[model samples]
Target: MNPLEIGSMVKARYKTGAYIGRIKEERGKFYLVEVLAVLKHPQQGDLHNPKETEGVFFHERRALAHHEKANIPKSAVSAFTDDIPDYPASLRTALQQLREDLNGQPASAYRDLALSNMDSLEKDYFG
Candidate 1:
């Protein structure tokens, strides 16, 4: 299987055909891709997370090369939230865990993104 790089768009083999999206995070065995579109209507739970995971992680074996044969329109595969920056899966998961450790309260979007630097930044800016 070809290795998928972060930010690279790929065609993932689905039951009926293929779904196209960008590779967001590469886990050891799977890639957390952001689905841009599918060949047909999505079945129930086809989307991993409507708010978080725009696409599901298909196995590396199921990933196909993105090409003209895919016939996915650029417009279909390019919708992304501009305000939220992409974070590595591990980092995001860790941050979520840290949030849990602290309390159940959700951090603001900016604070969430900067959690890794919270301690140092807090003294300089927050104080």
Candidate 2:
């Protein structure tokens, strides 16, 4: 690859990929680039906010330009959650018992429940 010159637009490939503004400074094999456009990746949070990441230094292997092409395809990135717990049968049984207790209540008791539901709605929405 040709050495990058100052004030040249570039597409830098990292975990995902990004298009950036002109090259600012160089230190050995790394370039300090002004971030322009951040391409999205599935596993990562939003990196496109310029206020958050103003500029970044990238190695030559990760930095590219319009004239050049990537030799290897980008690696697949993803996020996975493995700690989610299953709902217990005891909790289900407790819910069933609560439903049964409510079902046996008289009409006036249900009226009170209805008023409680309305009160909850008012407190949540109007407060």
After superposition of all CA atoms, the RMSD between model 2 and the true structure is 22.3
For residue 16, what is the lDDT in candidate 1? 32
lDDT of candidate 1 over 11-118, digit per residue (tens): 555443345566676555556666553333222222443213134532211122222233343323332332332223322333345435434446653333334343
Identify the candidate with maximal lDDT. 1
Q: What residue runs in model 2 are displaced by over 4 Å at the alpha carbon? A: 45-127
> Among all windows of ten consecutive residues in candidate 2, which has the lowest summed lDDT?
72-81
Candidate 2, residue 103: lDDT:
52
For 5-99, candidate 2 gives per-residue lDDT tens digits of 66555544444444333465554555555544333211111235311212432111122332332232112211212332212322233233433
- Cα-based lDDT at residue 47, candidate 1: 40
State the number of backbone clashes in model 2. Answer: 0
Note the residue pairs that clash in candidate 1: none
> Residue 55: error of model 1 in Å?
32
